[model samples]
Target: MAVGAIGVVFGDIGTSPLYALRDTFAGHHPLPLDQLHVYGIISLMFWSMMIIVTLKYVSVIMRADNKGEGGSLALLALINQHTTGNRWGKGIILLGVFATALFYGDSMITPAVSVMGAIEGVAVYQPEMHPLIVPMVVTILIGLFLIQSRGTEKVATFFGPIMLFYFATIAVLGLVSIAQMPQVISALSPHHAVEMFLADPFRGFLAMGAAVLAVTGAEALYADMGHFGRSPIRMSWLAFVLPALVLNYLGQASLLMRNPAALESPFYFLAPDWFQWPLLIIASLAAVIASQAVISGAFSVTQQAIQLGFIPRMTIKHTSTAAGQIYIPVINFALMIAVILLVLVFQRSSNLTAAYGIAVTGAMLIDNFLLAVVLFKLWHWKKPLAIGLLTMFFLIDGGYLGANLTKIPDGGWVPLLMGIAIFTLLTTWSRGRALMRQGMAEGSIPLEVFTKSAHSSATRVPGTAVFMASTVAGVPSALLHNIKHNKVLHQRVVILTVHIEDVPYVEPAERSTVKDFGNGFYRLTLRFGFLEETDVPAALRTVTMCGEAFDMMKTSFFLSRQTLIPSDKPGMALWREKLFAWMLRNAASAMEFFRLPTNRVVELGSQLKI
Candidate 1:
């Protein structure tokens, strides 16, 4: 698992040596390739990794996992469970959602930037290869996305060893360069970083923006924790990944100190001429693996968001029986388009850098905020201690965020814009769902009243009819519509309400609560962990109190399809209501999302305004 963490969890940060230092000197925010700048930037990268990745995430944040699951959403759910249920808790929830929105932006840019940075090595091999760089990156990216449908486990089995090799190779390469310019090792001192910043505050500050690239994928340590577990990821990072990355950055700095012109491409130049091509090949593979991790994270986020009701359900195809190995065609194709467009527009890795760090830094800041919440409210840490720890984290994250903000006009706006757009959609969907429930609740009838009074009033049909509802107490809008239109109720009416719990996984024993409401009516409330997929028919088989076991062929599932009409009623803005309506129009049908038997499902449409 430690080895696998090397392959999947650390890909983005591991590959940073490929362009991180190079961009510091030659990127849009260029700095002098002198010893002061070299030492300062190298020192900044080293401490950023130690402080941000090691201290904040691995030590503090990873401990905040939600039922062994880690990520912004999972963490949000966990924190939401513990915090004040007033507007303050809602505010934190919004922050977490926006962090998730930032993640989507990061997800899109990671593939484009990481892959392009790796392929740009060809330019070092031969400057004439510049024109082919974009095409090669585009081809590789398209191929990567195209193969996402076919799960990565088979290929991922070998990822650990391959990435281990890549890390070892880079470490060795760094050692060789450090040997030639041993003085570069002195840059490890915090003094150099402070001195350089003091010497030229503005340039050092701007360089801090590019230096952030070193720890770009640090969040993955938390995001991908579920895949490899906390122990493996932390062990891999502390033992191997951190050492290799630090050495490589120092080596790049050493190479620059010896010959300033090496700033053109210090990573490639650090390699012996004969080994450059092999290094490039290994680097490209690492980049693809890094991109793979981010892409998979995107899929996981989409699944979580849907289950948590932040996004509309999309067609989710489980590519493997292995837990969390799933695919969403809509998300896949959409990401592919966004990634390709980013590559085409940015053209070079240096340009992409301007857009890269903003999303990550923003996300890191949000994580710290969530972590503070966990410490005070959930972990029951002393306020002073929690405040002190949070102060330190804020200082580091705030500095990085401030640095990255300087890039907004250059290209940082790309991810910022994307984050805003996604955040809007997510908030709109959530608010709209709340308003929807409110509107539905207005006309909802209690189960006892409906069953006792209406059972005798309606014609009875054979077999069971399951009416899906948002709440267990009320008569489902679908049932109301169905009875009003058809004027009949089935012999057995199951008022089924699926409750997505805040936790990640619920035990089968605790997954359902069945109540016999009497008179051929059974109120069934199915509970699922937020991470668990919902399958109505499957869970229904567990119902012994329903008289007989459920048979898909004999049972008919009824779903309510609400046609949302833009309203002047007190709620969201007019535009947001329209946006929610559009999103609803495109969401996957309930039958598909809940894994119900398609042939046994019936849709009853009703109009609602919020």
Candidate 2:
């Protein structure tokens, strides 16, 4: 299981009762409690959970795995693999990529909102704590990022029990309130939701954006499925988590109807004075886990992005083998900066809520779109069954998205700005890669004659040498530079290329392909699934099974690095080219991506621009 998977995947949606009820009442279109309004809000939350989380994700979409991995991109890859020639593949791919881009935006905002909201509980008990909120949040955020280098193994152990207690606390509180006001149980009816929407269509629609916050991190459960497996997650949701969530929401609403003055923080108001401070600390810690989950997910996604050619390869370190824990320093710090800025700019948790739901709901919609393709095209499910399931999910997701758009003028600009920035980066990197590949193709030299002549003339040295190549056929520019600088050749020379297949998982038999290029020279290519972690050194050891003995200590690895230069070329826009170049310059080296030993690695620089 992922170290903090349960907390990260379930916490955001789990904690929705904290503010969802209050927000719905006092949100963009504040609704008064009629029996119908209460029923409507409850009904919306129920079906939102049903369609967005359960039916669409847990039942249907989760089945569309890329070699037992599920996510927007992974699902996209699965669809593309099965239906490459279909007309809809391109559209589905774009939707998946777009969803992936939006997910980055959500990753940034979730930390800010979750942590800030939990810390904001201080204001309820002691208004004096308000002034220190931002700094405290910033400090905590910094501390969280700092500890990432060390990994989350110890911290993750507490996630399940703590979250279980948190859920139980809310459920008990709600049950108590329900005993007082039995009418709250009636809110589960569908009529209440429809009546509320029809009676005050505009206001009900506007409340959806805020309402959607209740289900913000639902996608994480699906994304992190590979870590915990489908059965455990499914069982957790059905048996304990879902009931607790619904009960707490109902209890909060029941309490509100009796005491509208409790509108400020119904979550805290539910607790007694003795329990408040402890609850605050627990909630705060839970929020940190929630934030950490998304941050780590961003790292995993970034690795996938690089593998699929949407981004450049970076140094990815696997922090733990048992838990599939990973840490990417560049991504960690980047997320830290963005999250802190979000907290500073938004100032309050309530304000951040506006920006939180859009990206998540948008991504969920894309997931449904891709899942439809999986069900009908890939899984070969009955078309009517797939259509029926997908339609329900789309309508619910559409409502949530429609609701969130109203928040744009409010504090919603935060996610929109982040989304645009991320989308630009993703598209630029993807396009830049295509152009670079084209340029490399034009410059490439055929290997047949060069290999024949070079192999016969070159002298053999003492040990093995591994050269990292960008392509299978052409000699890497780095190899040429290395040859010029050091005329001496190793006794055994291997040209190695690491390729990230667009699919999610690569079969073991297809992991690598090797050819004897005559003399002591050999050429090898390593392939990885988008969902599988890449450890080049580990892969090299396994190549021996394929009839290649890779002696690590004896192998000296060489890689090519490009310093991007902008030219008046008919390619990408000048600004994007510069941006791609900037990103490339700062990216981690191939030695790290391939897990080559530091002492034996060599880098060669070449100038290229798109």
Candidate 3:
């Protein structure tokens, strides 16, 4: 598992050395290649990793997992489990949701920057090939996305060893360079970082916009915790990944100190002339693995959002028997388009660097708020200690964020704009769904009342009918529509409500809650964790309470397909209502979403004003 964590969880942060040092010295916000500036930047990078990734995430944030799951949505769901009815719940939810929103921007930018940064090594070794860099990056990214549907299981088997080799190579390159200039090791001390910033406050602050790149994928540690577990990820970071990255950064600085012109591409220069091409190959592969991790993380986050009601149900395809190896076509293609555009527009890795750090820094700052709630309200840490830790975090993250904001006009606006648009879409869907549910529930009849009165009022059919509802209370629009149109009820009627719990998995023993409503009517509620996929037929097969076991051929599934009518109801703004209506129309049908048999399902359409 620790080896796997090296392959997957550390890919993003591990690959940071490719561009983090290069960009700091010669990026859009270029710092001098002198000893003072180089030492200062390396020192800051080391400290940022320690504080943000090690302290906040590894030591503290990973402990806030939701039933062994981690990520913004999982953490949000965990918070909701405890703080659902609190007055401040809504605000915290918005912050958590926006953190997810920022992640989309990060996802798009990561592929563009990481891939381009690695491929740029070719241009560094052979300056004549520079003109082909963007095209090469675009081609590589498109291939990466195209291969996503096939699943990463086979390829991922090689990832651990490949990453291990890459890390070892870079560490060796750094060690060789440091041997020539042993004094470069002195930069590891935090005092150099303080002294440099004190000597040139404004330039040092601006340089942070680029230096923050060193920890671009720090959040992946928390987000990918579920895949490898906390201990494996922690050990991978502390023992293997951290030492390699720090050594590589110090080596880059060491090279710069010996020859300032190495600033053009210190990472490649660290390698001997004969080893440069192999280093480039290893670095490019590492970049692909890093981008793959981010893309997969996007899929996972989108899945969580859909289950949590922040996203509309899209067509999700499982690429492997493993529950986690699933694919969403919409997310895949959407990310592909965004990444290709980023590469085309930004053209160079250095230019893309301007757009990179803002989203990451912004998300980290928001995590501080989420962490605050966990400490005070959930974990109940001592006041002074928690406050002191939080205060330090806020200051460090606030500085990074403020510095990154200065790059907005250059290219940082890209992620900020993307984050805002995605945030609006997520919140709109959630709010709109709530309003539509309320509108649908306006005149709902109780299940007990309907079942008691229903038997005598309608003719009895032979096979069972399962009417699905989002909630357990009252008669569903589908059930009401089915009886109203057909004027008949099945011999055995079941109103099934699926409740998505806040945790990641629910035990099979606890999934079904059956209540006999009398007169051949049974109210069934199936509980699922937020991370679990739904399969109505499969869950139903295990139930023996509906007089007899469910046979697929003898059962018919009924679904309510709401045709949202945008009106001047006191719900949402007109534009949002229309947006929700469009989303409803486009979302995957219940039969597809729940893995129900297509031939055995019936959809009843009803128009509702929200």
Candidate 4:
């Protein structure tokens, strides 16, 4: 899992040295290979990794799991769990959801930038191939996405060894150059970083944002921790990945110092021309792997988003019976199209690099903010340690965010546009859901009254009937209609509300809150961590522990499908309100989300105007 997880989490950051060194030198500042610039860049990279990756994430943020899962949703769930139904919790939930929305933008751009960057080497080696780059890339990208339905288990097996070899090759190439100029190692000093900034304060600061591209996928490390476990990721980074990355970077700097003309793709130039083509092939393969990692990540994140209710559930296919083997066709195709378009428009990795870091860095900044809340509020860490760690991470992340801002005029507008579009969609969907629920509640009977009236008025049926409600306190229209239509109440009634808490993972203790409503009727509120996937049928199986055996054949699950009544409601804009309604109509049935038996599932429709 660590090997597989590494290819997913660290690929973006891992491949950064490919362009980071070149971008920093020829970036907005265009600094010379003076000791200060070299040392400053090295120092900044090291400490950025230390604070952002090592301290904040590995040491602190990973500790705040929602059950055993960790990610934006997981952290949000933790805050939600502790804060309960409070305004602040709502705010944190929005922040977390927004962060998640931004990740979609990152996911789209990562493949575009990485693949473009690698393929551009073709131009460097054979300029004639430049004309074919976009087409070639498009073809490969389309093929990659098309195969997603088939699953990546077999393809992923080679990812570890290939990435390991790539890392080793770069490290060896870098070390060879560094051995010739051992003084390059001294650039690790913080004073050099300070001096470079002081000498060209504005440009240096702007460059930090582009430099941030080097660590774009840092958040994925934490998001993926559940897949690989903290120990494996931590050990891999400390023992192997980090050291190799540093050595290669230092070697690149050493070569840059000796041959100032090597600024054109220092990564490839570090190797002999004879090896350049082979290096390009190796690098391109690595880039493709990096892109695949993010693509798969997008699928996983989308699944969580749908389950959590911030987004409408779309058709989700389980490509494998294995846990987390989800394939969301809508999201996969959407990303594939965007990435192909990006490659055509940006044309080169250097151009797309400007658009890359902003979304990722913005997401990373949000991760730090949420981590702070987790450390102080959830983990109950002492004030000093929490504050210190938060401050360190914020400064490092802030520096990169500030730098990336400079690229806005030079194509950085891509991610910004992408982020705004995604954020709006997320906010609109979440707000719209709330308003729709409010409208539905206005027509719902209070649970207490419904229980009293339906007990005797409704005819008795032979088996169990489970009604899925948005809220536990309100009676679902499905239940009301079921009784009205058949005039039959089951021998047992279960009002099950699946609450997608705004957290990453849910602990076992917080799994279900059960209340016996008397007369063989039960209210079950199942709480799931954002990290844990929700299965309705599986949750039903646990009702026995609450004093009821779940008989599948005798059980019927009911869900209310809310239809939209577009009106002059003083809620959302007319256009957005209509869009929300359309989305609701298209979302996958609640029966699927809850893992309910398809044959026993029942859906009722009710019109809502919000």
- Among all windows of ten consecutive residues in candidate 1, which has the lowest summed lDDT? 79-88
**In candidate 1, which residue pairs clash?**
none
**Candidate 3 lDDT over residue span 215-322, tens digit each:** 888899999988989999999999999999999998998888888888778888898989999999999999999999999999999989999999999989989987
Q: Any residue pairs clashing in model 3, and if so which? A: none
Query: TM-score, each model?
Result: 0.99, 0.93, 0.99, 0.91
Off by over 4 Å in 2: 1-6, 85-87, 457-462, 481-491, 502-509, 531-533, 545-548, 566-568
Clash count, one per candidate:
0, 2, 0, 17
Task: Please give the lDDT score at residue 288 for candidate 1.
Answer: 97
Q: Write the residue-wise lDDT of candidate 4 on 49-129 in tens digits.
A: 777777777777777766567788766766766787666777777778778878988889888877777777787778788
Model 2 lDDT, full chain set: 0.79
Candidate 2, residue 463: how far the Cα is off, in Å? 3.6
- The local lDDT score (0 to 100) that residue 475 gets in candidate 1 is 90
Candidate 3 RMSD to the real structure: 1.0
- The models' CA-based lDDT, in order, is 0.91, 0.79, 0.90, 0.80
Structure candidate 2, residue pairs in collision: 209-403, 209-404
Ten contiguous residues with the weakest lDDT in model 3 = 561-570
lDDT of 1: 0.91
lDDT of 3: 0.90
lDDT of 2 by residue, 88-189 (tens): 877787788889889888989888888888888999889887999999999999999999989887878888778877778888888988888988888888
Per-residue error (Å), model 3, residue 306:
0.6
